[model samples]
Target: MSRVRIAAEIAGAAVLLVAAIGIGAFLREQRTEPQSPAAAPLAESLAAPTQRPQPNCAVLGQVTPVPVPPLATVDLANGKKSITSAEGGYTVIVPTAWLVQPGIIEGTAWFGQTRITSYDPKTLPRPGPEAPGILPPSFGISLDLQLWWNPKGEALDQFAQHMLIGPDQLAVLPGGVVSVGGKQAYRTTIQDQRQYQPATGPVITTRQTRIVWIVPTDRNDRVLVAYATPGESDLFPEVEKIVGAIVLTTPASPTLPVIHQRDEILGRWLYDKSGAPIAGRRAEAKLLTYGETVAAFGGGTGLPRIDRDPDELFWLVAVTGPDLPQGRGGPGGTSPPTAWIMYEAPATNDRYEGAGTRFASAGTWPADFDALPDRCR
Candidate 1:
């Protein structure tokens, strides 16, 4: 063969060999790559159904069954009261002379009555949508009733800021502090009449109201009682009389403090109120001091890692399946293939009520460091 022709043939052979090796490598790669597990069934089980089961409309409507609790009657005229039996999980207290109205208040989510004594429950609607009934009258002594019926601890701060402070009707005044019934309270006056617009439009209005933020001395609770009247001038005198007359007997909480550290929480523990583990069955924990900003993991789950901010009133940490990378598992070990969670630490004492201290909202750190989950006595 001529030299040029031989060289051309050799080059052609080299090209074919390269192409063959490339194809072989591609095939090997395809075989070696791992296949992700089929996440459909897992996802379906983990995800809440978009549609809820509808009741059988064809069936005739049945009368609603009511659970009866023991009712106690009080004769205000003679100042006589009797408790037959405490049946409901919650205890209801009324003044001797107050008239109790039975039934749900209009535009309320639940059924309850307004008890009118010297004070009118009808006048006091719940501070937020979650609560219903008449708000307390303007006695000048107001309570910032922080509501968190089923909220995570980390979200309590944000809930307070957005709901109470955002109203513009109430403003946190500078250096407003007082003592109510021996409880150190922070008082702030409402500068203007604020209106909250519900889905149906403005359902409630307030004017010249004062909010007293009472932080407990040693608990994770804060109470915001708002006192307002039609007029705007200083209502401190009436507030003093009303506040002085308030008899607050601390109710027993299901969750008691197992460990109290100065501004740092560690380990896994169960929450007292809900009897659920503070460390969700699938949670992890790290020691965070007061004022350190911790990033929340997972997505959409408003779980907050307590950060160190002097203004932060509450700090709690919790985790769940969605907070983990593997997603939340179900009873049968099923979980979503993908999940997201986040943790937040709020700077306001309004996160937890009924157990907050006067210094709680002041951002005071705990002094000792003891993580005792077993001590949940």
Candidate 2:
């Protein structure tokens, strides 16, 4: 593989990271709506019950009453209670041992252990050489309810089908369709592994199970609820109960917007052979762009890699666009994407030039296109 191809792949990963923030913002703006006020009964019924349950007790609520109580004002160590955030549009009954906080931005909300108040994923300071791990380690188990706006008219199942799974990083378990809030959803289980290096200890491999719920929001976004637990633990049933009880106050729209920015660069591109018969050299590629980055899929020797061997191979590249000048408000100039090739690969162009040209066009994609991909169907 050529170094250019390797660099393109790395660029793709960086693009995905930056694009994620953009996607989050899009979801927030397009899909989110103010939730209806909590029902009156939801508040009165959620008050602490007269009888106290065991410390390990878990409570799930079917409805969120109005006049929502303030869990933050009361001490959680005393006993378990059902709480609802009228502003957030969902309710959860947490044990006295767990702490719950209302989401301040968009539809974000949190429920879990107390140590979280000081730790913020966005603002947390980086660990130096002496402390290379999260200063205060996170609890082995965590749960979060996230809402995303989906401007694309993609169903929950369709979204699942397009999910890019990195073969080397994650193992996805067989998942099937499930229902949430009376709407169809896709539920899947994923085994994720992370490598962390601490200053005082050798590298550590941590494994965890993530339960994912992707439900179409009926508008521009979808609601994604996730529950993560230690790989060896069985918290599915408990988590499911919590997920099953969620009710949305916002109504779903029947139609989606006619246009989306992603459609412009999402398609197939090719470099036709100059002069040849049926055996003429030809190259084809597919690209998907979201937010500020793009993901490339297809096989061809036209890609670049620093090292290569005799083995046949395919490639997936995630990359960002060329940076513009700082004053122009864009990523400043950066090296262009490169291509690589290997003999006997499933897909290959007659020459690297053809592939390189195709990739370059994709790297600096525009907002309009004269042709789209058949594969998009």
Candidate 3:
């Protein structure tokens, strides 16, 4: 080989040796470098042991069974009693322990009767007279009225107003929603003062009232189940458990018509104490039939009064209208009813008018003849 070529080859070999040394140094540095602290495990401790859930006392509490009582024993003349004739167009199992009573105002198809029964004192409060601790059991037949007409929330507010609470009234707590009696329901708890009559003085008993509003699926029907106790605490858990056990099987179809015969009498008309009509002025009449008997009243000149009752055999005055304003007097507001007083009874005549009262007048008829509107005709 030429001397210059040999010198070039030697220089190339020296450069290759330097490159190999540099690569080896870089790899060695990489292998010996310390790892970042963040990459290391935070601690050598083991993970926390799995926690056991706390036991719920409500679920564990012993349930008190409701006592059964005879129907005759429950029906004490003054006490109300009603038997379950129908349930959802099906036969129902009569609750052996409960005593049913006819509603104070009877004859509506939707409302049958109220139910009454005493619960275990351990589970409920003991009954005492004069603001007694006794629970006045009640039941309602489902009506097809508009549900939106009376919202459960608003109804609950009304119930709260009627309830008597304790001196140390606790705050009301919302319990959310739950299923009750196979129906959707909202549950809530309220702490209130219950008035109790003591031999010495009036005692204010602290209590918790649990309310459940059940909205039916088929109709605008709703069932309200309420349980109250003497304490400033929650009774929902127990109340729900007890109410859930209630099996309300439908009863047999009523032999009598679903709507009583008297329902026909419930409408607007005019009448007097003798069933006589007042001349020159007409009074709006309304009838409310319950069961076999009927209640009729007339208003417009003033609030209505009971006019007649074929069954009751006498006229009974029920309610009176308020005094009219100066210019807004009489049925037309042109003049006050002269000796014109609204009256209600079981019977009345066609024409009977006195001074200050016009006997002849014309007015619009109600839309429905079967029943009167809730407001004045």
Candidate 4:
């Protein structure tokens, strides 16, 4: 099996381009008759938000709690470009010199001298008619923003302590705290060594520096911001400036009618390895609701398949079934799933277990699980 870097996994389906008339048709289909005035108040009242005391940022594992200035007040006067994402639920100012391409899994913006990439689970790739044949721009320096969920509300230091050395080594920094999007956040500096084989020579070792920021959000989630630079290169100060100008919009709370335990597993799920979207392959889990019993099966390419029987082979693990585990999901699984388990390959025994992240429903999932076995098994 070829070893692939999880960090390199960024795939987005191409956005569908439609004519004005097509958009009109879509709008018309969604139009419904107006409700009576007598019922309008009840509907409005039901949608009103309930008030609760604000939670302390520090207690929530946020390091800095400085007052945040209005997003418009930021010194973005020199910026010639602005990126606003209704789906990403955030707005930030970038230099006009940067090149921007927004995707559902991750958004890439290339600054003349730097590249900034932002990723959040709440923002997923909008399903396009097909995959766009677009190539990502290159930059010597990269800034990465990813989403992290802290449902248990672990302390910043404790959570940081539990961080894995995945593909890199991290050294905790003495820097007090950093602020982003008017929220308190912590920072860490990491040094990583990467090896690549040359066509005609031995492997080369390269050292890089990554400065990361952990910024919390409204939900029990946080955005991880990191600035990566080449050997001996210092770009945190410049990158921090771009990050500071960010203003994250609150994520929309999902509203759905009460769901049955079995039907909750119906939506699309993106297969992930250790929290990162798997490259190239699109994995989906399907559940057939049979009376009161929900049968589950997992299928996807680019990973090993579990064959238990000859007639049918599925990748699965037995959980309590009804009550799914609560944890963060990736592109496919938007909200925390009821329960989740990793997909384990039989070869390594238990070395490589692929986890599935819940994503928004595309409304086009196949009812049959047979196709999955064909591609996966």
> lDDT for each of the candidates?
0.30, 0.33, 0.28, 0.34
lDDT, model 2, position 139: 30
Per-residue lDDT of candidate 1, residues 1-377 (tens digit): 11111121123223333434543343234223422345333323333321222222121112232333423455545553322212211223333543433211212111111212333434543354421212333422222122112223322233234333222344544435566556655554434444556787555664444443332322242232323232232544543555444344432222112132322232222122344432222222222322222211211112111101212222333322222233223554554343212233322222221111111111112222124121111
Candidate 1 vs candidate 2, TM-score winner? 2
Q: How many backbone clashes does candidate 3 have?
A: 59
Q: For candidate 1, report its TM-score.
A: 0.32
Residues 257-354, candidate 2, lDDT per residue (tens digit)? Answer: 11211111111111112321211112222222221111122332211111111111111121211211011123644422222111111111111111
Give the Cα-based TM-score of candidate 4 against the true structure: 0.40
* Global CA lDDT computed for model 2: 0.33
Query: Cα deviation of 267 in candidate 4 (Å)?
Result: 15
Candidate number achieving the greatest TM-score relative to the actual structure:
4
* Backbone atom clashes (below 3 Å) for every candidate: 60, 28, 59, 12
Residue-level lDDT tens digits of model 3 in 1-377: 11111121123223333433543342234223422323112211211211232222232122243222221223335433223323322111223443233221122122222222232222344344433422323211111111111223344434333332223344565555666557555555555435565689667463434343433323232233333332222333433454454334432221111121111121111223355431222233332222112223232112011111111211221111111112222465354222222232222221111101112111222223325422111
TM-score of 2: 0.37
- For model 2, state the Cα shift of residue 38 in Å: 59
Instruction: Give all TM-scores, in the order shown.
Output: 0.32, 0.37, 0.35, 0.40
Task: State residue 355's C-alpha deviation in candidate 4, in Å.
Answer: 7.8
Q: Give the TM-score of candidate 3.
A: 0.35
